[model samples]
Target: MRGVARTTAFLVAAAFIPIIALAQTPAGFEFQITLSKQAAQRLASSGEGITVQASYYGEPKKGAEKHVDEMGQIYLGDERIDLPGKAATARINGSGFEQAAVKWLDGPAMVNVNIFSSRKAGPDNILSCDLIDGELQVVRKSRFAVHCALIEEGMQTELKP
Candidate 1:
């Protein structure tokens, strides 16, 4: 009886070894990147040569917790301000590029990014900024100054209600 019990346990353990091994190994995957010349040129024209550095941070601005109401209006004191994309237009001004536009991504919170450059400015460089809304809300601003020997880092953009 004892010998039979031990043999039964050994057989059960051996039966599960192959199943466990299969579960531990994952199947293979494939990745591909296809970019057209026109699309590549469009991206390059946005701002390619400039090096940009940015850090997103948090702060307690006066209305940091305030957001636009359902009607798309941001109320501050006696005045009512409109939210960007609703009625307000975002105007990006920098040193290098004469023309700039906002490219919005698909998400719950609207994300608009702007990339621009200036060749004749104080510190000729690129600028990238994104306004995001979601679990964590904030406006991120980054600058790439080309001419400054040591570019004085600017303030990190924070979430402003």
Candidate 2:
């Protein structure tokens, strides 16, 4: 009888081990952007250029997180603009080509990203752009600079098993 009781207790404990592990799994996030037809065209035109810079804020677990900057130069007769596409782990993933993950310490982590462009690359060449309401619009000389939008499915993180 005592053996039977011990066996039952061991089974119950074993069943909860996987549940506990799952609960303790950490959470992660990813970011992505999609360009519109006009935006793509503008980015592919000669003498046109665009730059995206992102800064992440969070706790100081492994010192200060580094900023990420990407620049795209458009050329005449170009067809496509190569933009970075991949979800970066909320935390530093040790990959030099990815952004560090967000760290929630005092509150929710925050990521502030700015996208700027110029008809011709140089200093103070910030083109007016707006990314909201599911639309990306850039204006220059009181006309459309470029058009873009967030992908139909918004950015999300995939859970690891």
Candidate 3:
């Protein structure tokens, strides 16, 4: 039992080593990724669906623009260390949803925030959508915002702050 505890501790600590290293680097996103209430409310009340896409230009996976299907799968850089806490529920405009999960990893000169918005399926089932956006952004790290617009399929669109 003690060994198992030790292993879990070691693994958790190991995960942050790279993150700490990235934090030491000169470049990083200045803003933190929190729930944008206005955006969230807009999404919830909108008659049409929503989505966001961002372009990334940095080391590791440089020069790649990624597209997401929904606003929930947003992959942007956030300087804050967002713990993978239990998914919290939010109620906005009488519409609510769970955060589901927030995963992060080392990125080019920064830590990339991977967001997964939980979608309720049939009031009983829950499903995790695909990676909303996946790519390193060295170029737009400082001024990246999730774009809310109508982007046609297979079209490369850069997010606007």
Q: Estimate each model's TM-score.
A: 0.18, 0.31, 0.23
Misplaced by over 4 Å in model 1 are 1-109, 120-151, 159-161
Task: List the lowest-lDDT window of 10 residues for candidate 2.
Answer: 7-16
RMSD of each: 25.6, 21.8, 18.6
Per-residue alpha-carbon lDDT of candidate 2 for residues 1-161, written as tens digits (9 for 90 to 100) = 11122111100101111233223322111223334444344345535565444333334333322322232211111012223211111121112212223331233333333445543634553233333111111110011112222223121221111
lDDT against the true structure, per candidate, is: 0.23, 0.27, 0.25
RMSD from true fold, candidate 2? 21.8
- Residue-wise C-alpha lDDT for candidate 3, range 39-69, written one tens digit per residue: 2343345322221222222232322324221
lDDT (tens digit, per residue) of candidate 1 on 1-161: 11222111100101111233323322111111112233233334553332222211122223433443443332211111111111112222222211111112112122223222333233454332222222112221222111111112231332321
Q: Against the hidden true structure, what lDDT does model 1 obtain?
A: 0.23
lDDT of 1 at 28: 10
Please list the residue runs of candidate 2 whose C-alpha ends up more than 4 Å from where it truly belongs after superposition: 1-30, 47-49, 58-104, 118-161
Model 1 residue 30 lDDT score: 11
Which candidate ranks first by lDDT, i.e. highest? Answer: 2
